[model samples]
Target: MKKTLIAYFTRTGITKKLAENTAKQTGADLFAIEPVKEYSSSYLICVGQAKLENLQNARPAMKAKPQNLQDYDTIVVMFPIWWFTCPNIILT
Candidate 1:
């Protein structure tokens, strides 16, 4: 079987659960891309922050990263769609 890595960034746990389930079914390594500084839990605050981050083209620091990326033959990235695009943290 080809080695696979499932990397994802989640803000409200929805994408996280989907990534987890996909990883389980595909037998792939799972990695969650977390930011060094978390955004506010409030939906409105998060939306505001997203807008600010987009305006600034901010690439927030990721708390964790996958190891041995070269080992994976296939990679799957998952994240929630914000403003019709992936979150800034995912771009980091």
Candidate 2:
């Protein structure tokens, strides 16, 4: 059987919940793509930061990453849309 991985970045808990459900159904390993510097809890503040990052074409640093990515035959990435695209951290 091919090994699968579900990697996700979530600001609110919504995307995390979806990733967890998908992982359960697919029997895949879960990896949280966290940023080294967390965004502000306030939605407005976060939006501002995300907008700036987008304008700068930034790739925020991650706190952790999956090892041996070659081991997984399939990898699913999930994240909420920020500035009409995935958050900058997802690029890390």
Candidate 3:
């Protein structure tokens, strides 16, 4: 059987939920994009961290990167939009 990959990042789970739906429909393997350093779930802290990173032009490193990228012909990337932008810097 062929396999597919669906990688996603969600701070508040909205995008996570959507990714799940896509996976369900497509029978794809889902992987969460997590940072090397976990952060508090608090909205205040999330905002602060985002701002700090943006100010420093720093991208929080991810805990893991996609391995065996060629194994899956279909790769679906799902993430949330913050400040009217998708933070591409978080891609690892």
Q: lDDT per residue, candidate 1, 1-81, as tens digits? A: 589999998888999999999999989989999999898899999999989999999999988778999999999999999
Model 1 residue runs over 4 Å out of place are none
Q: After superposition, how far is residue 84 of candidate 3 from its true place, in Å?
A: 1.4
Which sections of candidate 2 miss by over 4 Å? none
On a 0 to 100 scale, what is the lDDT of residue 61 in model 1?
91
- Better model by lDDT, 2 or 3? 2
- Among all windows of 10 consecutive residues in model 3, the one with the lowest summed lDDT is 83-92
Clashing pairs in 1: none
How does each model score on lDDT? 0.92, 0.92, 0.80
Q: Which stretches of candidate 3 lie over 4 Å from their true place?
A: 1-3
lDDT digits (tens) for residues 2-90 of candidate 3? 88999999877898999999999989999889887765599798778777777887777888888988899888888887677655345
Q: Work out the TM-score per prediction.
A: 0.95, 0.95, 0.83
lDDT per residue (tens digit) for residues 1-92 in model 2: 79999999888889999999999998999999999999999999998998999889899999987999999999999999875778899887
Which residue window of length 10 is worst by lDDT in model 1? 58-67
